[model samples]
Target: MTKNVMVLVDEQHRLDSVTAAVEACGVRVQRVMRGMRTIVGAVSDDAAIERVQQMDGVASVREEKSFAVPPNHRDIPQ
Candidate 1:
């Protein structure tokens, strides 16, 4: 199962190196947030996330949450 993740980079390492490491771990990079020291990407499964977490420059790896609003909500006039 595929999983979306957000990776926080440590200050000691360069974002490029960390990004390369993340991509090497089989993460399909979506977008890079340089200002926030975060990388948004998707991985194949738990194993992939673990691999990313173990990388030297990675500070934290967390699952991304998605929220959506129903188009036909009873509270709103349809």
Candidate 2:
């Protein structure tokens, strides 16, 4: 199953290289935070996650857990 994940890389590594590595694993990058050396995206499957984890510049790969909020709770008071 595909899952959203956060990919953390070494701060000193080049962002482009890191992105390339993740993309090569068949993962889609949703957002990139260069300062934090982090990339958020989805991996096609468990094997893709493993591949991403083994990448040279990757520090860690963590799945993103989402929590649902009620629609009423999301409204702000005027």
| Candidate number with greatest lDDT | 1
Q: TM-score for all predictions?
A: 0.81, 0.78
Measure candidate 2: CA RMSD: 3.9
Predictions in order: lDDT: 0.91, 0.86
- Model 2 lDDT per residue over 1-68, tens place: 77999999887678899898898898899999888888999987888888988888898998988886
Model 2 TM-score?
0.78
Name the 10 consecutive residues with the lowest summed lDDT in model 2.
Answer: 69-78
- Which residue ranges in model 2 land beyond 4 Å of their true spot? 67-78
Best model per TM-score: 1
